[model samples]
Target: MPRAILDGTVLAESPNTVVIEGNHYFPDESVNHEHLTGTATETVCYWKGTARYYSAVVSETVFRDIAWYYPDPSQEAASIKNYVAFGRPVQVEL
Candidate 1:
């Protein structure tokens, strides 16, 4: 499995991290929500529907819009509807 880490903390870990529209979508259970702070930021994906974001704050290091999820994803992308993903310098390793 590969894990996404930020500020020395694990953000997400999964065996199947899908990249859609450039964002890496990890399984919902793979994310560590304790360090994630929901934000008002959102963007529409033509096929994925509207995606919401979370600012991952760890050890005083805040990565803006580091994580996202499609609350109401399109049927085609439904598998990752509630799943979260990372971006903007989020590091991933096995």
Candidate 2:
């Protein structure tokens, strides 16, 4: 199983996760929306398409752009669509 944590809080956990480039992409339902805030941030990957970012708020601190997901991935990377991946400042425990 994989879990996403921040500031001692478990933000998301799932047994079914997709690993791409060493990052575990948790399914949409596994993410806890309560701790997330939408950000006007996006970056494009040549093969993954557009990735949307999100900020996580925990213990009064906001970690910006620490999480992202591709809602409409390129055909080659379609398995991760709608799945979320967390980066530094946020921890993914396996």
lDDT of 2 at 17: 93
Clashing pairs in 1: none
Best by lDDT: 2
Candidate 2, residue 33: the lDDT equals 86
The residue-by-residue lDDT of candidate 2 on 6-92, one tens digit each, is 989988899999999999999999999899998999999998999999999999999999899999999999999999999997788
Task: State each candidate's clash count.
Answer: 0, 0
**Backbone clash tally (model 2):** 0
Top-scoring candidate (TM-score): 2
TM-score of each: 0.87, 0.97
